[model samples]
Target: MTRKTVRIAMNGVTGRMGYRQHLVRSILALREQGGLDLGDGTVLWPEPVLVGRREHALRELADRHGLDQANVSTDVDAVLADDSIDIFFDAAMTSTREDLLKKAIAAGKHIYTEKPSATSLDGALELARLANAAGIKHGVVQDKIFLPGLLKLKRLIDGGFFGRILSVRGEFGYWVFEGDWQEAQRPSWNYRAEDGGGIVVDMFPHWEYVLHELFGRVKSVTALAATHIPQRWDEQSKPYDATADDAAYGIFELESGAIAQINSSWAVRVNRDELVEFQVDGTEGSAVAGLRNCRAQHRSATPKPVWNPDIPVTESFREQWQEVPDNGEFDNGFKVQWELFLRHVALDEPYHWDLLAGARGVQLAELGLKSSAEGRRYDVPELTL
Candidate 1:
């Protein structure tokens, strides 16, 4: 089989998500597995060029991964200028992504990036326009849809298990420790408004795609945002005003006429089996899916509970639901998307999750924040390049 190396200039490998998920689990894992077979008589090998501001951190990461230090560079411009680099992948801070992507597009490289592609809808739209104008293949990270639980949920949808879907309820969050006693689980910038950080800006993209891809396009949204913790310590044990919203409660109206209510918060403690969970109820069946597992209850199997104020309930409601079995081995969601994008770049395959789709996600986040600010429902408009 003929082998081809796809050089990926990956920026922001120092951040937690960038380092762990994208770099380690996805790109490096692909390298470890001896590359992806492209179905034709060819195998696509991924060669990662780590790019970021901190040269030492990049070098250290490269060393840890047994990668050549010569592939690590602090100069993104030089990396972009390299004609050999086929794709430019960004997992950098959201505020800085648009400009970097613009450069990569200008340098004639394919694009793949993490979402909130920009801080605003217009900026995101601009990137989409430029990439389309340049005729460069592009994609955004929509990792949640490839998750095991969500995949199971999608399977049920395809099998008509939900029969006339009715509504979806999602709960996502965990208490991020303030940097005072224990170092914060997340970066301090996540709580700062100026740094393009907030739960709405960060998570609404995930929700937008999940709702749009699985159910139907979100037609309208009514949301309320809050700064549950007004004060928090930074990385250096210095306290700062936590300006960004830590929690967001949203009610979304889907085009399919199903209502989705989601509660996203960083101040809440975990009570469920997973960090994030969605309970979808329909006419024929209902399913509750977490990050890894999914459980469903058919309308015929659903237990009826009598409302009794004075008497104790006897039915075991949780026990009635059947667990969704994994018929296939689930790989890391990030890695799966990387392989798909690589295939798209190498084989001219159809990939719908382009920069336009990412722009829609940014649009949702922008409108969600606006809805919260105005204390009113906002209609989601269709976006075009």
Candidate 2:
């Protein structure tokens, strides 16, 4: 039995992801519960040092989280120079990520970052390369794969429940109003192009887990994006110019000959919170997974259809895709990945979701952007060794 106490230096503790990853999830799951249960006596406990931009803000954050043993400060230099901290976590916005990460690597620390590794692909590749050379463990927050519902989908696939997967269709979208006037569903930066925010960069990291793990590596992609709502009202009744794409439609060609069609948008009105789901079709059967349900249909399934053109009709087969509740913790998204990462760090076990996995996500986003700009499909490189 090995008990490892890892010292963590949290970067970007002032922002949304920072507060959640650094304060809430990390503190609750790792510091309090001693990481996720790996079915043995391996405990990953984090002794965290909180860092932020402002003194008052950082101190308050540290106090609120009851991080008594934490060294809370606004000094980035001080945090980087500390020898005791084992890992440096960056959940900061994409714009400041490159410079901050470069500094962290120089300090000889393992790294954990949020999606869209850097604002650009070159920076992301270089960051991964540097970490590899430094001989330190690095990973990004790829929380989607561990989602219990999605995990069920993964289990079914690995269990051969979906025989010979043919294609994956992903529907991810929701309606977000400007929180300024009403309650803004998403932050203002999410809609601003200057903030390095968009459907492609923010959401593709999640897709990276789905597309690569389930269907196979994406061979190529072509995409189109649009800013459906150009002007939105802010909290102060000010009109804010929205430049980022509110909707994106794309097609991914996978090496396994399984094509994926994905859509991400902020303009769609749906009765789901952060609507994220996918339907996987196979030769012998098909399956659909959502936040609430995961179900499969075998060869014994029957086909149902409604033949009316003007009325709201429900197909009898639609009810076949039902909900399944897992017998484990089903809390926030960050918490799921938080415990998984700590378990990996604590035990030094084989964690397949490494830094390279995160970089592959950046590659997809980069190529998607290129495809939109060039008006042609681009090839996705083979990454896993």
Error of 2 at 338 (Å): 3.3
Residues 1-385 of candidate 2 have per-residue lDDT tens digits of: 5566778888777787778655677555555675545668755567778777777887887677777635886677788898887888887678888788888889998888887778776778788888888877778887777666687787778888767878998889888886555776666777788988788888776787778876688888888877888887765667789888888888998888988999988888875433887888988778788765687777667465658889876666567654444756666667766666766666666676776787788888878877887889988887642
For candidate 2, the per-residue lDDT at 252 reads 91
TM-score of 2: 0.89
Q: Which candidate has the highest lDDT of all?
A: 1
In the range 1-385, model 1's lDDT, one tens digit per residue, is 9889999999998999999999999998998888999999998999999999999999999998899999999999999999889999999888789899999999999999999898999999999999999999999999999999999999999999999999999999999998888888999999999988899999999999999999999999999999999999998899999999999999999999999999999999999989999999999999999889999999999877878889877777888999999999999999999999999999889999999999999999899999999999999998877
The window of 10 residues in a row where model 1 has the poorest summed lDDT is 311-320
Where is the poorest 10-residue window by lDDT in model 2? 316-325
The pairs that clash in candidate 1 are none
Scored by CA lDDT, what does every candidate get? 0.94, 0.76
Name the candidate that leads on TM-score.
1
The pairs that clash in candidate 2 are 179-183, 179-184, 180-235
